[model samples]
Target: MKKQVCIIGGGPAGLLLGHLLTQEGVDCVVLERRTGDYVLGRIRAGVLEQVTVDLMKRLGLDERMKAEGLPHDGFNLADGERLIRIDIKELTGKEVMVYGQTELTRDLMEASAGRGLEVIYGAEDVELHDIDGANPHVTFTKDGSPRRVNCRFIAGCDGFHGPSRQAIPASVGKDFERVYPFGWLGILADVPPCNHELIYANHERGFALASMRSNTRSRYYIDVPLTEKIEDWSDERIWDELAIRLGPEAAAHITRGPSIEKSIAPLRSYVYAPMRHGSLLLCGDSAHIVPPTGAKGLNLAASDVYYAAEALSAFFGKNDADGIAAYSDKALARVWKSERFSWSLTRLMHRFPEDGDFERAMQVAELDYIASSRAAQTSIAENYVGLPV
Candidate 1:
C-alpha cells in the first residue's frame, strides 16, 4: 500500500486526523491493533473543550453531539462544607460539552467510509521503519499475511502503550512523567447525576467526582489507593462513599443503581518532548497524558490532531513544509499549559498519603480564597473551559 500518510491507531485521534486530511484531499490510511468494538468499549473522559467540539463541527460530525450532548455553563468545586461553582460561561464566555469520548469516536469511525478515510482494524505487530528519513513506511500483519505501507509521513496516535512512540529512538526522545499515588475507582450507572453539573470534591476521606454522560447515565469516581482492588468495591459501597465525600446536598439527590461499568484507573501526567521526529508525528497519548483531573485527555488529543492535520495538509496540498517544521513547538506550547492545569487540579482535589496537616491547611486556605475571590474563580473557570487552541 502507498499513501501520503499512514496513521497508526484508529482511535479518535487517528480517525479524526484521517478525516481532516481526506477533506483536504490528502491520501491517508489508519491502522488499528484492535477491533472497532474493542476501541469503543474503552471508557474515557466526557468533557469536550471548544477545540475538540470545533474539530467535530468542522468535519460535519457534530449532529448527534449537539443533539445528545449536555452543555454546562459551570461546574462545582467542593471543599467538604460548600460548593464553589465556577461559572465558565460568565468568566470565559465559553462552555464545555459533556459527551462521552466513546460516542465521539463512534461518530468519527462511522463517518470514515463516507468521508473516504480508510481504516484498518485488528492490525497486528505494527512497526514503523525509516522514520528519521524522508520516506517512512509501516509494516504489520493483517490476517496471516504481512502488509507494508509506504508513506511520506506517519502519525503516532496509537496511544501511550502503542508502538509508535516506542519506535522513536531513546536518543531522539525524552520522557517527563509523574505517576500519582492513587487511582480513580469509577462507576457508571443508569441514573440521573447527583447534580445538573459536574463536581470535583475534596473531602476528609479523599477526592471524588460527580459527573454524567447524559441525563440518565451517571458517572462518578472516588480516589483510592493504587493498591485498591475493584473486586472489593461493591455498588452500594461506592455509592455510600460518594455520599460521604460529596457532602450532604449532593448525596440527597443521589440515585443508586447497578453499575453498567466499573473499573480502577491509575492516574499519571506524562509528556514526551518533540512530538515530531522526522516523518513521524506523535498525537494524543503517544505524546502526552494528563491526570484526567481536568478532563484534558481526549481534548488534548484533538488539539494535537488539529495541528498535525494542518501541517500535513500544508505539506501535501500546498507543498509547504513550514507547518510541519513548527508543529512540535506550537503543539507543545499548548500541551504544557494543559498539563499544568491538570496537575494543579489534581493536587488541589486529591489527598496525598504523604501530605501533612500543613498541606491540608494550605488546601483549605486555597479553597477559601477561591470561594471568596472572583478572580480565583475566573482563573479556574477559564482553565476548566479550556484555553485557546
Candidate 2:
C-alpha cells in the first residue's frame, strides 16, 4: 500500500500538490474549510510571473489562461505627467500576464475533478492529530458527522490563519515578521483601464496604481492609513483622487461605476524557516507571505507548491528524502529575496508620515536613479518581470 498524505487547505498549494502527487501515484486527500464556489470566487492576486506561466503551460493549465489573460511588457512609473517606462522584456527577456487568482483557482479546481482525489469541502472541527508521530491524522466534521483521516504524512498548504502552522512545534522553526503602517484600499470598477500599462504613481497625497483585469474591468489601489474608514470614501471621491494621481492623459479613459469589489489589505512580510517538521510539511502562504506591492504573493505560493511537488515526488517515487529535508531552506532562499524586493518597491513608492525630510529626499533620489540609469532600470526590470522558478 502507498503511504497516505493528508493535505490541509485546498488553495493553490494544496491543489497543485495533490495534482503532482497523484501523477506520481501517491495517495492524498485535500481538506478545505470553504465550499468550492467560495474558494473559486475569492478575489486576490492577478499578476502571474513568467515562471508561473511556464509551470501552468507544462501542467496543461495555461490554455484558458493564455486565451483570457492579458500579457504586458512592463509597467510605467508615473510622477505626475512625467512617466518612466520599465520595459520588462527588454531587460529580463520575459513578460507577465494579468490573470486573476479567481480564474486560476477555477481552472485548477475544474482540472482536479474526478481524479480519484478526495477534496472535502465545508469541513468543520478541522484539527491536526498526532502530527509529530508516525501516524498523523486530520480530524474534521463533514456533513454534520465526526470523522478522522489517518495518513503517513501531512502537508499544510493552508493560509496564515490555518491550524497547520499551529500544529508545528515552536522549537522546529523560527519566524521573522514585519508589518507596514499602511494598507492598500483596492477597488474594482466596470470601466476600461486608463492606461495600457500598469501605472505605479508616487504622489504627495498617497501611492496609487492603475491596473486592469480585462478590457472592460479595471483594478486600482491607493495607499491609506490602516485605520481609514471605507465609508468615508464615496464613488466621487475615489474618481477625483484617481484622476489626480493617474494624470490628465488618463482623464478621458476613466469611467465611473459601482465598485464591484472593495477591500483593504495590510502590508506584511513574514517567513517561517525549516518548513517541515518530521512528516509534516508546510507550503505556500502557510509558510510565508510577502507584501502585495511586488505582486509576489500568489506567484510565491505557486512556486512553493512547485518545489514541494518535486520534493514529494522524489521522496515517494525514489525513496529519497533529501529533497524534502531541504525544502524550507531552498524555498526561503527565493522567499527572502522576494521579501526584500517587495519591501524596497513599497518604500520607494509609498510616503510614510514618519519619514524625515532627508528620507523623503532619499526616496526621490532613488526614484530618479531608477528612472534615469539604465543599470538601475534593468535591476527593477529583472525583479518586476520575475526570475525563473
**How many Å off is the CA of 192 in candidate 1?**
0.5
**True-vs-predicted CA distance for residue 368, candidate 2, Å:** 1.0
Backbone clashes in model 2, listed as residue pairs: none
Q: lDDT of all the models against the reference?
A: 0.95, 0.84
How many clashing residue pairs appear in each of the predictions shown?
Answer: 0, 0
Give per-residue CA lDDT, model 1, range 1-389, as digits (tens): 99999999999999999999999999999999999999999998899999999999999999999999999999999987799999999988999999999999999999998888999998999999999998999999999799999999999999999999999999987999999999999999999999999999999999999999999999999999999999999999999999999999899999999999999999999999999999999999999999989999999999999999999999998999999999999999999999999999999999999999999999999999998999999999888888887
User: Once model 1 is optimally superposed onto the true structure by TM-score, how far is the C-alpha of residue 144 displaced, in angstroms?
Assistant: 1.4
lDDT of 1 at 191: 99
Where does model 1 exceed 4 Å of error? none
- Positional deviation of residue 62's Cα in model 2 after best superposition, in angstroms: 1.3
* Stretch of 10 with least lDDT, candidate 2: 245-254
At residue 370, candidate 1 shows an lDDT of 95
